[model samples]
Target chain A: MNWNQIRTVYGKEMRDALRDRRTLLSMLLVPALVIPGIMFAFTAVSLKVVKKAAEETPAVMIIGPGNSEPLQKALAGSPKLRLVPAASDYAQQISDKRIRAAVEIPPGFEADLAANSIATVKIYTYEGEMKSSFAAGEIDRILREFREAAVTRKLGERGLNASFVRPFEIKRQNVAPPEKVGGNLFGGFVPYLLIILSVVGAMYPAIDLTAGEKERGTMETILCSPVGRVELVLGKFLTVLTISLSTVVTSITSMALSAVGLVHLFAGKVGAGAKAVNAATGQQLPMVDPVGVLGVMVMVLPLAVVFSALLFSVSLFAKSHKEAQTYASPILFLTILPAMAAMLPGVELNAKLALIPVLNVSLIGKEMVSGSFRYDMMALIFGSSCLYGAAALAVAVRLFNRESVLFRT
Target chain B: MIEAEGLTKVFRDKKRVEVRAVDGVSFRVEPGQIYGLLGANGAGKTTTLRLLATLLKPTSGAATVAGFDVVRQAHEVRKQVGFLAASTALYGRLTARETITYFGRLNGLGDPEIAVRTRRLTEELDMGEFIDRRTDKFSTGMKQKVSIARTLIHDPAVMIFDEPTLGLDVLAARTIVRFIRDCRERGKTVIYSTHVMSEVEKLCDVIGIVHGGRIRAEGTLDALRARFGQRDMEEIFVAAVGGESALARQDVPPATTR
Candidate 1:
């Protein structure tokens, strides 16, 4: 295969792809804007909605509170939950969502506390209801604080300090750097999206270059040229690879920019300041080192090639652009399986997992974004992916060279 | 200089049922001569041209284009042959000049050489008016001109035209007929295919009547007429294809009239 011939084919295909409005839309504009736009809308809208829902004064009904005036006073004193009059049909009300929650105190609530016996406080809430759950949580906290106050008061009456009962304290601290913490939390899905975007980006171009040529009647002309099949296929492959890589870069960059934009937009008003910025958006912001991100992009190359080759092979089997699309649709789901596998928890980048195709890339990519560069595993993943990519490319080249497949009516 | 020695192509569908699309078809065309393969649709005319152009491998026998073996030296064969189909299939997204230049470069011409050839072909094909415009909006004639220019950009020694004027208008078909004659004048061996008997009589220096994947008759127009005792090329073609039984229904007068 002559490299010059390959370059010629590559240049022409690139020109064609650039000129095709459909290709441009699917490959560049959609990836670059869609993810970030979805992220922005979800972040900006959900932040306001969740905040508004949380701040609403949810009314709670306290039952059997007359037996314990202190408990009733404790529930009423809390600012987060408003104490509503006890109702005979509070259970029905909670189920209907008219009331957030209901608290039922046992008949001997005060006597049990005085005798130093354990007393159980039952809280009823609409399960799976966000607002009701939040209210239930507040009521639980108020009862715990009330118990602590009672214990302290009794201890002080006995002329003892509260520390006597509580000998030690447990405090949790996150030792990971902010970048690593963010990477670990948010980097899990980056590999999945990268794999999906790389496949999607290469999809249209690969089909256009192969099946599109046949449909346009240009395939016969190209086949009649002096360039060998290997050269032609490789040229088309390179174009697809370029498109896939650019898409990965553009969409990832767009996502990062949108994250920064969202952080800046709602920083102070919604407590989306530094502390809550990452947590507020359901998706963790990817804050890994630039070098790590670069390394991850590099790691994505072989997988991109794999996707390009597979798409090329499948599309070439189709006789027309429309048929090629039909042939290629199932591959999207096939790719998503491995990508989604990488997103699953406990699927770490071990030696065994490195041998799997898309899943391995996802695992290593996740690690790279999380500020954990396991060179040994990275090498394994890269080398294996290259082998798989080459194998897939060889299949594509063989398909291109096949007379039966190419000239099928 | 093109030769086919019993070249054959067999196709097998998914059920493994074999159909011989081109069965032992053989013909030869000398330099500066236009050899026309005259056959009806589905008679393997396109398959024969494709075989000569190295687009398909012969299941048996061999063919050569400009003395390069279609099977073993397929790349060399492609280098010396320019194949055009009936569709006038130019890349719609590319300008006429861009399409010519792209094919020229693929055939190993450098940029400067491609530019020279592109300009010469454009002027020769009289496509200057729409040379720079994207071909998607081009008329049928304009697109055919672009396809012709693209085919000749590399100046190959053997040219293959598989019914190049099938869907063209009268003017477009006239342009292609003139182009085929010009190729002959330029000393390029041309293999043209069409079912139109008048086209064969007008242009072909030699005619090969192909039917059912085999050549049934081969000779110049006059020679075929003299051999078959038929003055008309259509009758000569009918006789060459199947003799009396196939033509008795179409060419013969009614028995009552006789």
Candidate 2:
């Protein structure tokens, strides 16, 4: 009830938390370093590995080179595929990774093709191995080119054009802006990280401010002051919220910078690899909009409060920091499950889902960051989250006032 | 002034068994008087003090501190009372001054007033050297001084000391004993709890001998000696709680065994 007392507690707790190495690690350093660390490893390492795999020429063995001289010649002419001598151990070689893949040309394959008969060419590969997959892909490409050349020759002999085989063309284009494309790509990921970091950021301080006080014998001293239980809880909750928000902000900024740096760094050096990444994401590696980033941060505020209060309440039940951690693990997992639910395909923010606590924030956050704002749903989720936060805070205050809990032995 | 009438506290264990941590206990301590509640550990001494300090509500009966009901006006009672225990500790990350300033603000003191009181307590407790340093590195005596300073920051009228010297070395214990005496000299109503008979004999103006959650005997040290016909304070305490069986189990010196 007393604002000044709450401010005093908040300021003191913030100062104390800032000085604590554990809290600082969770709040600032870990998120800041971890996001960039992960991003750098994910982007740079993956790009290098994929580039190497694509560039490395994998040896291939043709089972029947005599049956298809033109096919064999075309495969040999390709710079990406190296044709090895026919051998009985070609399958063994593929399995042992000595050869990346093997091609089985059926008997009379050229005759069957010239007679317009269907024949299947089997491409043997080491499944799931990157290099073998790349080699198999190269063989498939060369086979398609060989078949296409034969088709064109057959069409010309019949006095037909290449277009005679095709009726119409299918073309596709992305209507959404690049920012939305990036948002759609990273939306689930960014909010997932922010929500998790926010919860984790609140964890240590919530435990320290409540159970740590009990462990250190400062609980009774603080409780003996004129500050009411509500005020005390509010002050501690605000401190936790402040730290949690700082972590969210730090991680968002770190991830944004890392994404931008990685995009620029690899865009030129690994142009083809970058294009592959862009193709995988279905965009040109769009930058996350600054406005959308700010919006996500704003949307995460109420959710942070919910986490802070819940963590504070759960940790207050424990009598020591270690016990508090034990008590808080379930809450962490519980928050994570709902936050991750938003990342699931087809899990969109709806009227029903918006009423849920963490899931709503995540769903709405994903949408908000992707340049979509359903204000009604946003207001609903925000309001519901605020309600949950208030309820959790009330529970924390109630627990703080309970003699059984505060003086638990 | 402080008063209590038939105060009691009951707790339920994990097995659903009711345990009377504090029974019907009554006492009075006027301003400028030191009332010591002498009992062995877990004898409801801490519970009784906690009840009067508004840290815990009583299951029955009532108490008042500095003209405020401990339960209904708990906030006001806390504002007027300073409570400390040997178990109560300092924020290790905070400097002594910050700790004092924090508690002062919690007690509803303004910045200027807190500043003034911090200076006075710092000088009076002789904490000038360590006041600006973090308490995690402080010795027991220094930490206890900081705790005391924090307790007295708002200058409450009533003081509660619950085994404040329990874990201290001789010098630190002496400092606490001196602080209690100073509280009495400043016209503050004080309730001190300890199992140490020497502390009662040396500091208490009135002593309440507590046992099994009840006050078994209440009077001055001289009055208790006269009533029990025992010269030594330990003998007087033994006689007050239980006559001969407790005396056999007690570990006091052989000279005071009789």
lDDT of each: 0.84, 0.86
Two-chain complex of model 1, DockQ on C-alpha atoms against the true structure: 0.46
User: lDDT tens string, model 2, A1-409?
Assistant: 6788888888999999999999889877876897799889987887788778877889999999898988888889989888889999988898898999999999999899989999999999999999998888889999998888888999999999988886587767778887787777777776777788888889889999999999998888888888888888898899999988888878777877887788687768667766786786566766456676677777778888988999999899899999999989998899889888888878877899989888888887787778778899888988898898888888988998898888886
Q: Relative to the true interface, what fraction of contacts does candidate 1 keep?
A: 0.74
* Regions more than 4 Å wrong, model 2: A155-164, A270-272, A275-283, B244-258
Tens-place lDDT per residue, model 2, B1-258, is 999999998877667677777789999999999999998766788889889888889999999999999989999999998898987789999999999999988887788999998989989999999989999999999999999998898889999999999889999999999999999999999999998989989999999998778899999888998999998988888888897686455442111000
Query: Lowest-lDDT window of 10 residues in candidate 2 chain B?
Result: B249-258
- Model 2 achieves a DockQ score of 0.52
TM per model? Answer: 0.93, 0.94
Weakest 10 consecutive residues of candidate 2 chain A by summed lDDT: A280-289
> Which candidate tops DockQ?
2
Judged by whole-model lDDT over C-alpha atoms, candidate 1 comes out at: 0.84
Q: How many clashes in each structure?
A: 0, 0
